[model samples]
Target: MPKSVVSLWLLVSACTTSPSHSQSWDFELRVVARGLQVPWSVLWGPDGWLWCTERPGRISRIHPETGEKRILLSAIEGVYARGEAGLLGMALHPRFTDSPFVAVAYTVYSGFVELRIVRYRYDASRDTLLDPQILLANIRVGNIHAGCRFLNLPDGTLLLSVGEGGIPALAQDLSSLSGKVLRIHWDGKVPADNPIPGSFVWAWGLRNSQGLALGRGGLIYGSEHGATTDDEINLLQPGRNYGWPSVEGYCDTPPEEQFCRDSNVVEPLYAWTPTVAPCGLAYYDSALTHLPQFRHSLLLATLKGSTLYQLRLSQDGGRIEEVNAYPLGLGRLRDVLVTPDGRVFVSTSNRDGRGAPQPDDDKIVELVPKNQGIEDTEERSLLRLWCQERQLWVEARAPVTVRVITVCGHVLVEWRGLPQQRWSLQSLAAGWYGVIAWDGVRREFSPIVVP
Candidate 1:
C-alpha cells in the first residue's frame, strides 16, 4: 500500500474496537438550555457560544458549560408558526469574528406567510442586534412545504434551500426561487459561477428540504420531505435539477415524460420510505475517537422517527448505508451538530405540536462518551494531531526524531527549532502517523490521525 493509505489504515485500527455486545451505548445527556418554544436550529458561534432559534421569531444564546440561557433577539412580527412555517434556519458569517453578521430565515404573515432570509449585525457591547438587512425576499410560503435551510460553505458562499411553495409546479419553474437551492455571495449577490448568470438558482426541483450540509470533498447533501412516500437525501451539484414533482424519488417515469428530460437532473444518493422527517445534518470527520464507527459518517436528525440515523459513507463516495439508527427518546429532534470538542449537540422541537413532551424534552442535549475504564488497560489510541500546537500524545518512550521518517525509513516532515512551539500542519493529509514529544531528556512516541 501507499504510505498515505497505510497510515490511514493504521490510524483506523488504533482508534476502533470491536462492537460491544451490549446494545446500550455509553453516553451522558445534558440539557444545555430549556424554556425554548419550538427551537428550530442550534449552532456554535465563532466566540464558542451556542446559539439557537425559536420558532416564534426569537434568537437565544446558551452557555455550554453552565447551561445558562440568554435571549438575544425577540418580538419580531410575522412569524407564521403553524405546522412547518416559522423561524427556521440561521447561519453566521464565514468571518463571524470580524463581521459579526448573522443570517436568519423566517416566515412572514403577509396573507400567505412568505419565507424570507435576512441578515442582522450583532452588537457585542450592547448584546443586541444593530442593523438588519434583507438579503433574499418574496419567497412564497404556505402551511406546508416552507423549506428553509442555510449553509455557509467553506469557500465563503451562501447556499439556501427554498421549498416548492406548496405547489409542486413551482419546483420546475426556472423563474421562481421556490423549490430551488439558491447560491449567493455574502452580500446577496448572485455567484458568477452559478448555472445561470444573474440567477440565484443553483439547483432546482426540490420539495420541502429542511436539512442542508456539506460533506467531505465539498459535496453538498440535503434531506427532503416526501408527499406520501420516498423522502430523499440528494447529492447536490451545481446547475443540476433534482426532479421534484416531475419525478418523486428516482426516475419512475419514461424518458419523454420526465420534467427535466434534457435539463440535467440529478438523482438522490439515498431515499427513505414512510418518511423519517429528517431535519438537521452534520458530517463527522473522525475527530471523536470515542465513537470510531461514526468517524467520517453523516449524522442525520429525524423528527418523525425521533431517532438519530448514522449513515456510513463508502470511500468511493457513490454509496451510503444506514449503519446505525438509535432513538433519542427525546421529543422531536430538529437539529444535530458536532461541537468543536467532538461532542454531539441536538435540538428538540417538542413544542411544535409533534412529539410526546417530557419535562426537559424541548431543550438542547449534549452527548458525552462515558470512559468505561478501558483507558487503563487498552492502549491509548491517537485520535488526531493538531499540528498548530505541535503537541504529541506519546504512549511510550521513543526517539523524538521518528515522526520525520517514512515507513521505508526516509524523512518526510522535519523540524528543528524552539521546543514546544506551535506549528500549523496546513500541508498534511487526513491520516494517521506517529508523533514524538520530548521533555528535556525523556522522549515518547504517540500515534495520531490527521483528520
Candidate 2:
C-alpha cells in the first residue's frame, strides 16, 4: 500500500473508542510535590526527571515514577523571592544528552531586583552542578513588569522575554533590553542574523510578556499582561516592533494617530478582555480521536481565570479562534506543559499569595485520557457507548462505527469505513457487543456492551 494509504489504515485502527457512554469525566488529581515556596516553572529535564523552580531561588528535581524529590541548586546570587520577582523560567538544552546544560531566568539583588539569565552544567555521574555561566544580566527590574521567560527555538537559538521596565516608557525605547524578546546563540553569544547585529535584542515593544512558545512553521507566540483589560497574544517576529504602551490589542487609534500611526508596528493575532492573565503556553500533539478541531490549537494557562484556554487555529495558521476554555478551578494556574507521551501537566500558583487557595492547591496535575486503563465493570448500567469503538470516549459530533459478533468466528455487523457514520443505538436492547472500526486497511476491536 502507498504511504498515505498506510497512514489511513493506522488512523482507523488507532482511533478506537469506548461504548457510547455519557458520564462526567472524573479527573484524577495527583499532587506531584508540595512545600514549594511559590513554584514558577516546570520543565522535563535530562534523565527522565522533572525539574521545577521555586521563587526563593531553589531548583528541585522530582522523579515522576518514584515521587522522589531532590534539591539541585541554591544560593548562587540575587534571587528576589518577593511577589513575582524570583527564579522564573528554565529550559534544558536540546542536545542535553551530550551537553547537559540548563538555562535559568531569575531576579538578582543588585540593590534592586534585576532579571538575569545563567547556564549550568549538570554532572550526572556525581549528581551535582559543575560550571555556572552567567549568560545575560542587567535587565531592568521593578515590583512588577519583570517579564522573564526563556525558550529554545527549533533552530537552536535561545529566545528570552523581557518585560517593560517599571517605567512604561522603556517599552518604546529601542536601546533598553526591557520590554523585548532577545535571541541569542546557545553559548550566550549574539546571533549574527539578529535584527541588530552585535546586539542580543531580537524584537522590541512588549509590555510584560509572561509566556512564550514556538509553534508550527517556526512561529513564535507570546502571551502578554495587559494593564487593566486587553490581554493579548502576538506572533513574534525578529526585528519587528509590537505596539505596547502606544496601543493595546488591535489598533484603537487611527492610522494618523501619534503612537498607532507607526506602520512598522505589528498587531496581535488575538486579544482577550477582563484579562485572563495568561501565563505559560503549549501546543497539543496527541493521538486522541476527539481533538480534530484542536490539532494545532494553543493551550494557554490563565492565572486570573484559573482556566486552560484552547485557541483553535485556521488550517493555514493565519487566524485563531477561541474554541473552548476549561476551568481548572485550581487557583492561579501558572504553567502548562505537555509531556512527550501526550500527558498534559499544569503547575498552579495559588501559594503565590495571589488567589484563593484550596486544600491541595499549588501542585502539578496530570490529565489522563478518558477511557484508557479505566474499568467500568462495577457500573455497567451507567456506562453507555460514547463512541462506536469501545476504547474511545464520547465527544461532540465525533464519527463512530460499531460491529457485533458471536463467540465463534462469524460475520456480524461489520460497519467498516465511515463515510457518513452515525451510530445511535440508545433505543436498542441491552446486550454484549464487539465493536470494530476500519479505516480502509486495518481494523481495531473493542469489547463493549449496552445495559
5 Cα displacement, candidate 2 (Å): 39
Which candidate achieves the best lDDT against the true structure? 1
Tens digit per residue, CA lDDT, model 2, 48-146: 777888777888787754557788886556577776788888888999988888888888778776888889998877766668898888888676878
Residue-level lDDT of model 1, residues 1-451, one tens digit each, is 1100001112233433323211244554545666678778889887778988988888988887667777789756667778888898999898988888989998887767688888899988877876778888888867788878899898899999988868999998999999999998878888898898999999898988888887778888888888887888888888888888877787766862465567677777888777778788887775567556577778888886456778778775456855566554454789998766666888888888756554544777776554532222123222233323433322322223323322122335754333233444445555434443333332233333454
In model 2, the runs with Cα more than 4 Å from the true position are 1-29, 255-258, 286-294, 374-451
lDDT of 1 at 223: 86
Model 2: worst 10 consecutive residues (lDDT sum): 1-10
TM-score against truth, every candidate: 0.75, 0.75
> Which candidate leads in TM-score?
1
Report, for every candidate in turn, its global Cα lDDT versus the true structure.
0.71, 0.68
